[model samples]
Target chain A: MQVSVKYFASLRELMGEASSVIDIEENISVSELWQSILESKKVVFDNVMMAVNMEYVKSEHQLKSGDEVAFFPPVTGG
Target chain B: MLIEIRKEAFNAYAEMQYYLDELDIDGQYGATASFVGTMRDFNEDKNITSLTLEYYPGMTEKHLETIVNGAIEKWNLLDVLILHRVGKIKIAEDIVLVATWSAHRKDAFESCRVIMEQLKSGAPFWKKEETTTGVKWVEKNTPGF
Candidate 1:
């Protein structure tokens, strides 16, 4: 399965890129995907928010092929 | 209801006037409550020179619509308008505008407040601040209203 990952705000700076497409095994959860991605970065998972297909989802949410996943810091807009 | 996310600067008074004259909800609405959020010169004790806002284009609009609908469902609202700026924004410039119209003052006031609060925490917009020190992404804890 291919998942499109997006980083925003501080996460984009930390990731050094805006978005990427990664190949993953079937039935992987969002948390598992993050754990793999975070291994190469210096970022922590604290206070982070995630969304699948633009809707807020929990870490335990299951992923499917061609899903758009986004991660960002807490929102600060009014 | 109107929801717009754009980079162009807007005049709140002019926008409101145009909306009022065009929508003509004055006959049904006795009160209109509005809130405007502007970029501040300072944040976290640092002097902010400019601010840049980003969003998930399609999703941001969808979430805003959901919030507006929620407010309308909870209150007896005649109309609502939400305008948010994206991309580069300077200090003292308008960042967001939320307005609600209702037959009574209480409904308009409460719905306006709820929409702003929900938009702050629920919307998919992110802001980066440029200060004398450097550019930093603001870290915000969701506030309970």
Candidate 2:
């Protein structure tokens, strides 16, 4: 299964790419996918907000094929 | 209700007037409360030139709609408007405008404030500042108490 991963704001700068697609095992949790990605790049972000298909979700949320996942820092808009 | 995310700056008063005039409320609203946020020249004690705002496109509009609809239901508001700027914005320029209309001042005032507070904390917009030294992303927002 493949899912599209997106990074925004500071995360985008650190990731060096706005978005990418990765193949993953079925029913992987959001945190597991993030850990795998970060470990490969030697980067760490302790306070990340996660979203699946544009809706905010917990780290333990399960992923599915064709999901649009987003990771970003805490919001700072007015 | 009207929700807008624009790359250009806008006048809060004019936007509010235009939106309110178009509504067919038939003099149903007795109070209108609004809040306008502007860019400041300094942050973290450093002088700043301008800032760029980034968002998640479709997700941003959805989140804002949820916030506005929640406020309207919670306070029974008659009308609401929210406008936020994106891309580069100079210091002292308007960054956002939130206005609410209700039958009384209490509902209008409270709903307007609640919407702003929720938007500040929950919205997916990110701000990157151009300071005197260099550019940096804002990690957190000021407490909305």
Candidate 3:
């Protein structure tokens, strides 16, 4: 399956890109996705939070094709 | 009616005037209160050059709406607006705009307090300061829910 992912703040800078489309296996969990990305890239969004399809979802939330996955660093805005 | 997140901003006078105009409507709201948060050049003795504020796009918007709506539910307010700025903001820049309209001073005051307090804690925004020495994240002595 394929999905879109977004990176923000430190995560974006670390990833060296804002977003990208990638291919993954079916029913991939958030943590599993993190491992896969690490294997292919030099990005560290380790402590960051993620959301799937616009909702603040936990990493364990199962992902499907075409979902827009976002990763955010520890929040600071007010 | 405008809840914007911008990279640059002017003084909060315009939003104040805008709210005043709305609240001044006859028999609409008895009182209105406003506050403008500015970026101080010095945060606890740091000669900050600039501030880079980062926010979670979808979550930040949702959190702001939920907070403002919560305030409205608790207070008898007529209207409200919240504006927050992001990106590289210089010292002395206008950081935030908050406004409230209510039936009386009490509601206006309460709503303003709640909104401001919630922003400090709940809004999913982080600040990194570029100071004379180097860049550092602003520490939160008190965390919020």
Q: Give one clash count per candidate, in the order shown.
A: 0, 0, 4
Q: TM per model? A: 0.94, 0.98, 0.81
Cα lDDT tens digits for candidate 3, A1-78 = 999998776767778899999898998897688778877885555567777776667768899999988876766665
Evaluate every candidate with DockQ and list the scores: 0.75, 0.91, 0.44
Q: Candidate 1 — which residues are off by over 4 angstroms?
A: A40-42, B141-144
DockQ of candidate 3 relative to the true structure: 0.44
lDDT of 3 by residue, B64-125 (tens): 88788898789998888888899889878888888888879999988887897887766778
Sorted into a CAPRI-style docking class, model 2 comes out as high
Candidate lDDT scores, in order, read: 0.88, 0.93, 0.79
Model 3 steric clash pairs: A76-B125, A76-B126, A77-B125, A77-B126
What is the docking quality class of candidate 3?
A: acceptable
TM-score of chain B of 2: 0.97
TM-score of chain B of each: 0.96, 0.97, 0.89
